[model samples]
Target: MSGTSAGAPEPEGALEPEGAPAPESAPGPRRRRVPRRERERQILDVAVQVFAKRGYHGASVDEIAESAGISKPMVYLYLDSKEGLFLACLRREADRLVGAFQGAATASGASPELRLHAGLLAFFAFVSEHRDSWVVLHRQASELSEAIAAAVAEARRAVMAEVADLVRAGIAEGGPATQLTDEDADFVTHALVGAADSLTDWMARHPDQSPEGVTLRLMNMVWVGMGRVLEGEAWKPVTG
Candidate 1:
């Protein structure tokens, strides 16, 4: 008997006729080309995570490219350079955070207290959702080059300005009883922003707390003192 295996024969309906063109193989799935804006967003998203995780000095374009599933040259083509990429990430996240605050603060024709509360809630919600972005903006950017530091400072100032506007508006709306001077309002804005930044870090460490909960705590601490100050009562140090 021949040594050929019976299983090797072509199955019924599986064979093509001789001299006929070979059956065309099924075309592989087409690679969808992402839109320019979307691709840039994807690159920035990966860049933010890489920068946040590794810090600017530790992070590399090659690593970001690999993680983003694109080539180094492509990243450069899109973002110009490593510094440029980091700047883009910083600007994007900063805008997003600021936008959230503005949107919430201007949501309704309600009281300043309500607007401030909404802004705080939005701020905490953004921090909770974009922890990497917060890390990149808060921790990593400051340690980077001077240009990046300046850019970050500008973003911070923008956020502080927005909060300051809210504080000023609150004083105005509170009428003559709220005796906060422009200087006092500025100082209060700084305190509120600084406290919120610190508490954001604290919230990261204690993830069990909700954003609303954190917002409420901050509102309670800030508004009570603010109310007292607005009503012409200021805290004084005890004289020895």
Candidate 2:
């Protein structure tokens, strides 16, 4: 037989022998090596910035991985997909904000107003410090997947509940002037959240505004407004 003759053919089912060990396939995207915890954190950090800047859908896993100084396959190994990455980012930032606020509240033995002050100050400080994170949570995350939206909503509800509890305590101490029923507490809590959210949005837009300046302005508006409202006073626009 000539040396150039074709090699002997293997028996049938040679590629994958029955009840025999199959040759290991090369790694797929999911098989890439990465430190799961570290990679997940890095991906979340980069994803928040990317998603904040580009919005969720506009941003891609490749960009996030590149931003994190890794390959997309590595990112896939840590985070199953883009949606998973986004949810991870949302959860982290939400936990951070909630934990900070809760800590401020728990640590303070001050009055309700003081507690509110501490919490709000902590909140503004948090949002200012983590602008990208806040943007991811407040804007991009909310607008993306429903899972993300629900997470954001739940965080909001938690903050609102805390505010409602504070309001109830305020009503009890301040008597009729600051008194609030269940309905009033609900309305005020959401309104306060809305107001803080709006103010944060405005702060994000106006980066030139100092934190102290922003805090002072909000304090005057919020604390004074609450005091006035509890005293049977409110601001209303007059019709032309």
Candidate 3:
């Protein structure tokens, strides 16, 4: 008598009829919305991994999107095209590399030489820790088109300028021999960057070598020589 009748009003949010297909099971949980910028970054992160693993021509928007758990069209929507995605990876990695160098080199209170050493150490550390990023930035050069080349060049120039400034500062301080020009500084920058670029490969071959050791060796070889050059000693190339 006290129990509700069969036709009594059903409570709100009650279960569906026993055999009536379970009313679609309440939609599990809503997927939290990712903001556009965050979504783009997530897409880019997956893109970098794929691009690193597969060169530009080989990498596909489909795989990158799937890896990112998104649709291919969504990748295009976020990055425009595969080329755009590669460019984005290049720029982001380059910015990160540049930021690492600048942040280390500009560190307060250390001597100029130490700051420069710190910067080089930071470079090696970054390359070591971010092998995929380095691969994307370094190895992807072979796939360059106009925009890709330009993005790569821009990153190179930014790093060169930072090193050149340090070189110029060193030249200014070294007594009476502070005659280094911007051109001279750039020449040094090219050599240093080139060597560092090559060393990334060497680093891959020698995983046991620590970044600090690598940095020290490079500084002893290059930075010491750099100081001598800045002081106008001029270690000219050997001629037979």
Per-prediction TM-score: 0.83, 0.77, 0.82
User: Residue 33's C-alpha lDDT in candidate 2?
Assistant: 41
Best by lDDT: 1
Candidate 3 clashing pairs?
Answer: none
The clash count for each model shown is 0, 0, 0
Ranking by TM-score: 1, 3, 2
Give stretches of model 3 more than 4 Å off: 1-27, 108-110, 178-181, 229-240
Better of 1 and 3 by TM-score: 1
**Global lDDT of model 3:** 0.76
Checking candidate 1 for backbone clashes, the offending pairs are none
Question: Model 1, 88-151: lDDT tens per residue?
Answer: 8887888899899889989944787888889889999999999999998898888778988997
- Indicate which candidate wins on TM-score: 1
Q: Candidate 1's error at 18, in angstroms?
A: 45
